[model samples]
Target: EDKVVQSPLSLVVHEGDTVTLNCSYEVTNFRSLLWYKQEKKAPTFLFMLTSSGIEKKSGRLSSILDKKELFSILNITATQTGDSAIYLCAVVPSGSARQLTFGSGTQLTVLP
Candidate 1:
């Protein structure tokens, strides 16, 4: 069965701390890997990595794709309380909107 899983179920960080969220997966005929950040509303898109070395970044958040290891990592620099959210990792299958295999996600709580 194809699936994605994240480790360190939860993390507590102080303001200004840098944190990393991990996502691992096993799949068949996989198409792409996507990451999302969830607060109160549904998760907002973060990154989609298809190739390695190429990292997508916006301000304090960044991510890298590693198709070799079948996983990806999200990094936040100088974390803020607002950065607290559930980080989700999903697998975009061979077909579009075919439904993604998602991991429960890693909850990040940044203390002020």
Candidate 2:
């Protein structure tokens, strides 16, 4: 079974603070690592990393994958209170099933 682990399970910070979340996974025929941000109900896709050394960014959020280390990092710069949410990391393996193995997720709280 593919397993994913996220560090610092939860975080607390004030607005404008920069934060970094980490995720590590163990799977067979790894295909990609995807990041999602969840606020209330559904999780919104953030980035999908399929190659190493390439950083994907959107606004104040960015993510990079380290295939050699079997891990990925998500960085949020100058975060706002609206950025508070649960960050999820899911690993996709190359298989006909096409399923996603998800991490427990990191809960980030940004206070005003």
Candidate 3:
């Protein structure tokens, strides 16, 4: 079966602190790992990892992939109150299903 799990299901942080979000998965046909940020509307793409140890970063957010361990981590530094949002992880399958199967996300709440 294909499944994804995230740890520290929720987090609360004050502005300027740093946080890390974790996601692990077991998929029969795991092709890609994708991260998203959700705030009411459609989830926004954050990162997509297909190789190990290589990290993808943007602004204050970064992510790393580990294919052997079947896990990924996302880090946020200098967090702002506007950064409060749900971080999601989804698995992309190879060569067939074009849909992403999502994991229950980690809710991050940043206080002003």
The lDDT leader among the candidates is 2
Residue 112 shift from truth in candidate 1, angstroms: 0.6
RMSD of 2: 0.6
lDDT of 1: 0.91
lDDT of 2 by residue, 1-112 (tens): 7899998799999999999999999998899999999999899999999999999999999999999999999999999999999999999989786889999999999999
Q: What is the lDDT of residue 43 in candidate 2?
A: 98
TM-score to native of every candidate shown? 0.94, 0.98, 0.96
Higher-ranked by lDDT: 1 or 3:
3
Q: Please state the error at residue 44 of candidate 2 in Å.
A: 0.7
Clashing pairs in 2: none
Q: Pick the candidate with the highest TM-score.
A: 2
Give the per-residue lDDT digits (tens) of candidate 3, residues 22-106: 9999988889999999998789998899889998999999999999999999999999988999999999999778988888999
TM-score result, candidate 2: 0.98
Error of 1 at 50 (Å): 1.2
The reply for model 1, stretches above 4 Å from the true place, is: none
Better of 2 and 3 by lDDT: 2
